[model samples]
Target chain A: MSSTLLRTVPALRGALRASGAPKAAGAMASTSFVRGKATLPDLPYDYGALEPHISGKIMELHHAKHHQTYVNGLNSALQTIGEAESKGDFTKAATVAPLLNFHGGGHINHSLFWENLAPASGEGGGEPDGALKKAIDSDFGSFDTFRAQMNTALAGIQGSGWAWLVKDKAAGTLGLVTRANQDPVSGPYVPLLGIDAWEHAYYLQYENRKAEYFDAIWNVVNWKTVAGRFEKT
Target chain B: MVNIGSLWQYLALHSTLSGDSTNTNNTANNLAKMGLAAYTLPALPYAYDALEPHISAQIMELHHARHHQAYVTNLNKALESHVAAVAAGDVAAQIALQQVVKFNGGGHINHSLFWKNLAPAGSEDASVAQAKGLVAEIEKTWGSFDGFKTAFSAALMGIQGSGWGWLVKEAGNGAGLRIVTTKDQDPVVGGDVPVFGVDMWEHAYYLQYLNGKAAYVENIWNVINWRTAEERFAGRSEEKTEL
Candidate 1:
């Protein structure tokens, strides 16, 4: 039975490859060269840097344990796919697509999340000044309004998920969207700013008071990084 | 008007005096009072810790009380509002409620099925003998019972994020049995009848198993109520034959 199942996988993958179906946005970009491994990225600042807003203990676990787990899972999934591809067993690749999406999304989202924060000093929080600022004001009326809207939306997430400030490339508009679980905001929209609403992200700091956590997160928002993303978009 | 009022009073008195054992009168009254039937969370067929060792008591308690109850509550709210929308002929409002309906409805359906599909390990009856027909069908489809289990576990392990793995009986097309997976509380659709389902959501196993999903999947088999699967399979197959 195993052999019979394996036999058809390669043919299926070959057909998919031949059709050249457009991959979803933010798929494993370096699948060809990187093969199966994903390494966890370093944080831009110390774990305690966010202080008051986000604690060092939370940061340490969120990054070292939670983020590392995703990195490991993604790598394992990629390895399985690579082996199947090598053996012309594309069926295995097809089966592991969810792992790629889940862990891959986890890895991708966490990577962006780390860069999305900064220490209270220097570049963290305050306000956006340039094009990003104009976009926020133009799209959402004002910075305060945008903050209020994002906070409300983040607070309303029903489960482990994220709330994003995404720029629609085509429309050149900023929109607020919340995703359930580790699902990434799909491509064609550039993520300018995102708040991880997963319990692990804020539970340690704010407990059940999600609103308080949402309020605190803005203090550590890396406006500089967000503006850079906005410029590129 | 005098005659009609007298007749109505007499019928009401008779109904009250009879104490209608069928409760039809009460049902009619309630139906008239409430426009739609409200869905409620079903009580677990077994004790919270009945399937112990295999599934922790704490997991079952939270899963049933917290998770399942939330789904039932949200589903009722969604359906209640949807009733108003449907009555108003509000197409946009009805369309907007589709996700809420599917998510909550599916959660209700799937969890209800999940609870029934498990039993205390070793406590299952020798009724596998009575379910010979379904057993034969399973053997025919997967070469043997073990083969079917292997395929089912493989499918279960492959669920990317939160989802369920099902052993479904597909009617017609040879009355085949298929192993299928649905993402994020999606109930089995099409003409397939799910004989058994195992939730692969992290919340389902994270507390007990932590990240060891493989162990959870393996241990779950020990407590699966095969009798329930057999009954479901038998009923579905009979339906197909009749069709």
Candidate 2:
């Protein structure tokens, strides 16, 4: 299914260039009447919890402003996509394509990012136990090697993208892939975990060098949450 | 008889001599490569203030000092305890600590990649070039040079969130090269060598693009150090088959 994008094999390279301008989410919303959508979900821990790794300033801004922007933008996009679908203008829906992708992506990314982080207490951020540990060892050879690969690839992302640990059902193995823009994995793969690499996600604290942020992000990754994800899948 | 560090150094020295000077220097690479005693935070490549308006000095300040530092410190602590357990033969503690190793250690590894990824924005173009062999390979991998780029951009723009667009080799698999996308902390495939990658993480481009990641991805192509990638690819091939 993921290969379907490739299957069409249109002159996709140059065939899909936009006018190089985005219709503002606000502008898109001005035309719609979707009652301004859901608010940013409350982060479980206080903004200060991930401090030092993530600054209080950055946390406050990221959750309040940045995440909020995504929430607002996502609602706007969904409403626009809805309207476009109703008008039977798939092309018009496509015009707001970047916004839909961006805002929708932000909403999804932050939601996961927030849920995946927690305090390093007994109740949260606990180290992987039982099956998760076994899986890490078996799959990546050793946890150290697994961490090395993940961190390197995660840090290696170019612009605004995500690092994901997805389960490829066909491969029947935990697969790792980074998607640029807000593109998530599809079909057989389910997102076991995700890390947000958007500047707004960490720039206030991490600055131009995202590696700092990426490094720090591990401190708060809620492995128990991952364990739970593993249980369900 | 050789430790992983020396093993890597010997390989890297050979690579550098053969001209892949872009390889990482003698920093403690990862938790496994260096025992707990050896790990410390890596120093930054460029000055904190280098990226400037493209990225603020203030942001770099905190990002490096506080954020990256935490990863280094915690990774060391996590490994030290793990190693102690390992030496004492406490398999459970050692096993459990692997999670910490990945969480903190991965952070350090990823950050190191980020530091090397950027340059002074506009002037980054000077560093862009690849060796002749790699250029032929690029031509072979995805048709013409422009074809490779268009495909790469499409992959990049198609991405969903906080991820990466990578042009990577399939390890020792001689099936030529492939385009890959990795989620957080996912390594390049098995032994696949990563020659060039673009961080689509927001911090890499947010100051300029806002949510317009496509703009950021397109703009950075001008700054791509193709020369660096060329050398890396050449070095990988050379290391495997020595003169």
Candidate 3:
């Protein structure tokens, strides 16, 4: 119960104590929120879980190295943000702004992304369900068609960006938006689905062939996780 | 006055009220949670032969081969360089490479999705249901598909820099198909899903439309498979709330 309330706030100590999740509240009071800033999120599968479609080498590079870089960069940015805030140096804070947005965004995204994939164990090892599924159908019209559109958007990204199935916050809608760089998805939305079009995400196994990778990614998408996220949001 | 995004959201609500598929897989079903910036290239939904003629075998070949491939190679190199620099503890390199990492990395991600955005561009049956959804959304938002065509075209033409014009979900509320313009690789959503997008980048049209982003944007719609768009719209209506 206490855990559910933590996600919305940057701090939980006072809130917890006020709410009476005693043990949790005490623990929150005793701990720091940014323990390590960013760290490698635990992986749910072997690095080779999506092999053939997504190679082991690519996984290693992506998670171990790329995501780690985001973590580290995010940490550094946060540290700087703190220092600048202390000195009342808005300029310095601003200087570190993009770092916070990009690397920080990377850390957050990779974290969600990790849970969004699944292995091909059954009907779709990691396919979506519940409200997300109903939403997918209502929005895209059908499962097969959704796949095609996602593939197209995944393939259509020009330059560097992400293909996303984002939920609009203010207007309460779901729509597709392509983001440039590590830009946080705009329009105040929740990420229902995300596709990394970055080359490193698939270059090794698929080589320069991105289209091939799109087909295979379906084999491992974590629909359960995505469906869960949909439920919560 | 239900907009495209809201129309889908409303549909999702209806589906939820009706009660259909079980959602057990979504929360726990993740085959792999790969990185958006890591090593994953999307595969083509259709074969090279699949999108011939309207798209041309030659265009697809070069675009994917030369253009898209370059993004992959460059992005990897940037990562490699960043790793080495960080190991050596070079702050200068880290700062300098930030732009390289974002720009090149962004390029790789964007183009990958773009490839799949086009199928044959001529197929009328590619997910006819979704296409109809797009049409319906168009009508809902702008009174008709033709109105959607004009608005989307105008939005694309009005973009001042290299970027994209998207029909994206409005965020937590549900899908309100808003025509948004994002500049210089700016992301359409930090939260919502990016279902369909039109590239207004010069590279996307220079070879074809050259300076006329309007012409290119207009022409691309000719190939728009409304069925696919409708499918995406239908999926947007997919419910998360249990009945």
Q: Highest lDDT, which number?
A: 1
> What is the C-alpha lDDT profile of model 1 across B60-152, one tens digit per residue?
987898778777767766665565455455568878888888888889889988887788887753234545777798899899988988888
Name the runs in model 2 displaced over 4 angstroms.
A1-30, A34-233, B1-37, B49-66, B117-127, B173-175, B207-209, B236-243
Model 1 DockQ, alpha carbons vs. true complex? 0.09
lDDT, candidate 2, B150-237, per-residue tens: 9999988765555567777676648477888765444354676666776654545554455556666666665465555665566543
Candidate 2, residue A206: Cα displacement in angstroms equals 9.1
Per model, state how many residue pairs clash.
Answer: 2, 51, 156
Which order, best to worst by DockQ? 2, 1, 3
| DockQ of all models, two decimals each | 0.09, 0.21, 0.02
Interface RMSD of each: 4.2, 6.6, 10.5
> Each prediction's Cα lDDT score?
0.77, 0.64, 0.63
Better of 2 and 3 by TM-score: 2
Give lDDT tens digits, candidate 3, residues B21-138. 1222221111111111334445656666565444445445555666656665556556655654454456687788787767656666556545545656556544434465556666
TM accuracy, model 2: 0.48
Minimal lDDT window, size 10, model 2 chain A = A13-22
